[model samples]
Target: MTNALTITDVRKTYKNGTEALKGVSFGVRGGEMLALLGANGAGKTTLIGILCGLVTKTGGSAEVFGVDIDAHPEQTRSMIGVVPQEFNFNIFERVGDIVIDAAGYYGIPRSVAAPRTETILKRLGLWDKRDAVGRTLSGGMKRRLLIARALVHEPKLLLLDEPSAGVDVELRRGMWEFVVDLNAHGTTIILTTHYLEEAERLCKRVVILKRGVVVQEGEIAELVRASGAKNLEDFYLRV
Candidate 1:
């Protein structure tokens, strides 16, 4: 099967002498959930930024659905959706408008974007909050709104960063179920999260990064076995 995303020897170095990524490489197949595990500043966000065309790599190449990001940024980015760790929407804007505006960024027509936004918001339990201003929503609601906005474009690949952060357990579980449903419907997912058990349960494959270097990558079970660890948390620590 063709990969939804491919990174080959990707490298990034900052002006301050910080190497955010060092020869990192990976492939994410369609309909698969790949968990990128790492401690704070392990380069997870940097890698995601590069993939989303928000950050330029110092070296190497990354492609989304066969389109090279550096060579065809607009084309590559159009194929992907990103739910960032930080809220990027105007806080005073209505939730519905925020989603619709995001869809427009991808050149989606209002007619096409509206229905999709409605469906996603309703599915994520945010339909009633559609008219509410972004600042009026709680943190969890904002997070769900972000995810819904990302889906408005019907991207083939979804990138989530710490999606469960600040969410209640029940809401987090609901988010997981929603993600599973999305993947079942053929959306490829790449997520970075501090929650190991969530990753263990939801992702078939895992990548462990330490100080900007990929230390391990493979099936979750294989990684657990190889590390002789009871779970992803233990495996991560061991690595």
Candidate 2:
């Protein structure tokens, strides 16, 4: 089967000689949930930013489905969705409006985006708060709102950055279920997270990065066995 996302010899370096990604390469197949694990400054976010077209790469190539991201950015992005680590919505805007506007940015008409917004908000348990200002919602709600905004256009690939960070355990688990359901329905998911346990449970494959280089990549179970470690945390430490 063809991959939903692909990267080849990707590299990124800042002007001050800071290397965020060093010759990274990977591919994520359709219907797969791949976990990108790394410590701080390990280039995980930089890699994700490049894939989402938020950051320009210094070298190498990336493709979504079969379309080159650099050569056909708009076409590639139309088939991709991203939920960033930080909230980037207007504070005073109504929750529904925020999602609707985001969908519009993707070239989705209001008539089409409105129903999707309503369904996503309701599914993520944010429907009741739809009319509330963004600032008035709780942290978890805000996170869900961001996710809902990302899904408003129904992209084929979804990139989630630290989906469970700072949220309560219950809410975290709920988000996992939501993600799993989305994947079961055939959306390719690529997640960058610090929570090894969550990655172990939710991702079939895992990639570990250290100092902007890929140190490990394999099926989660295979990686754990090969490292002679009982869990992902232990394997990560050994790396």
Candidate 3:
């Protein structure tokens, strides 16, 4: 089967002499849930940025499904959905309006966006809060809203940047179930997260990055066994 996403010796460096990704590479399979693990400044975000076209890479190449990321940016973007680490919606806007407007930007008409928005919001447990402004929702609700906004357009690949960060355990587990269902339905997901347990639970494959380079990449179980370790945390430390 063709990979959902592929990167070949990807590299990124800023004008200020900061190297974000140093010749790193990996590929995610179609319908797979993969974990991208790293510490702060591990180039996880930069790599995501490069994939999303938010940041440009200085060297190498990447593709979504079979489309070249750089050569067909618009086509590549249309195939991907990104949930950033931060809440990016307008604070004062009604929750439903935010999602509807996003769909409109994607060229989805209001008639089509309406019911999709309703279904997505309800599925994520945000329907009751639709009339409320974004600022009024709790942190977990905000995170669900973020996921809802991302899924409103129904892209093929989803990049979630710490979707459970700052959330309570109950809500975090709920989010996990939702993500699992998403993957089960064939949306290929690549997640960047600090929570090792979450990664261990949800991902079949893992990639470890350190100092802008890929230090390890393999099946989670294989990586743990190869490191002579008990678990992902231990294997990650060895990386």
Candidate 4:
């Protein structure tokens, strides 16, 4: 399969002289669900930010489906959708409009964006609350709304950043199932989550970061066998 994303010797440094990503490199295969594992301050967020064009890379390269992100930023954005770790939408906006308008950013006409918006909203179980304001949704619904917004444009690559954070157990599991279904239907997914078991269960491959660099990476089973660790969590702590 072709690569959905490729990162080669990618580097990032902040204005304060801190290196947040130090020559990190990895490839996510087409139709692959990859887990980006890291502790806090491990450059996970920075990496995602770079992929989404929210942060600029200081060196090296990143590409989406063979298209260089820096060279063709608009094309990159058109191919990828991101569900950020935080709720960044306007609280006062109508729920449906928040999602529908997101498609406008991609130049999707309102006629096409509206139906797609409704479809994603209903699939995420937020159809009944379409008229409600963003602030009125519960934690789970709010998380679902982020997903709906990401999916409305039918992006081929989806970057989910701590999507289940603050979500209830049942709701989180439901999301897992939904995401699996999404991948099965052809969307490549790169997931960043603090939940080790969730990563083990959902992703085929993983890249673990420590202090802004790739410390370990491989198939889930291979990493476990090589480290002689009982599970991902045990292996994570050791690294």
Per-residue accuracy of model 2 over 169-196 as CA lDDT, tens digit each? 9999889999999999999999988889
Residue 154, model 4: Cα distance from true site in angstroms: 0.8
| Residue runs of model 4 more than 4 Å from their true location after superposition | none
RMSD of each: 0.9, 0.8, 0.8, 0.8
After TM-score superposition, the amount by which residue 151's alpha carbon in candidate 3 deviates from its true location, in angstroms, is: 0.4
- In terms of lDDT, the poorest run of 10 residues in model 2 is 44-53
Give candidate 2 misplaced runs (Cα > 4 Å): none
TM-score of predicted structure 2: 0.98
lDDT of each: 0.92, 0.91, 0.94, 0.94
- lDDT by residue for model 3 over 1-239, one digit each (tens)? 88999999999999999999999989999999999999999999999999988998999999999899988998999889999999999999999999999999888999999999999999999999999999999999999999999999998999999889999999999899999999999999999988998899999999999989999999999878877999998889877
**Compared to the true structure, candidate 3 yields what TM-score?**
0.98
In model 3, which runs have C-alpha deviations exceeding 4 angstroms? Answer: none
**TM-score of each model, in listed order:** 0.98, 0.98, 0.98, 0.98
Instruction: Please write out the lDDT profile of model 1 over residues 1-239, one tens digit for every residue.
Output: 88898899999999899999999998888789999989999999999999987888999998888889988988988889999999888999999999999999999999999999989999999999999999999999999999999899889999999999999999999999999999999999998999999999999999888888889899999878877899888888888
TM-score of 1: 0.98
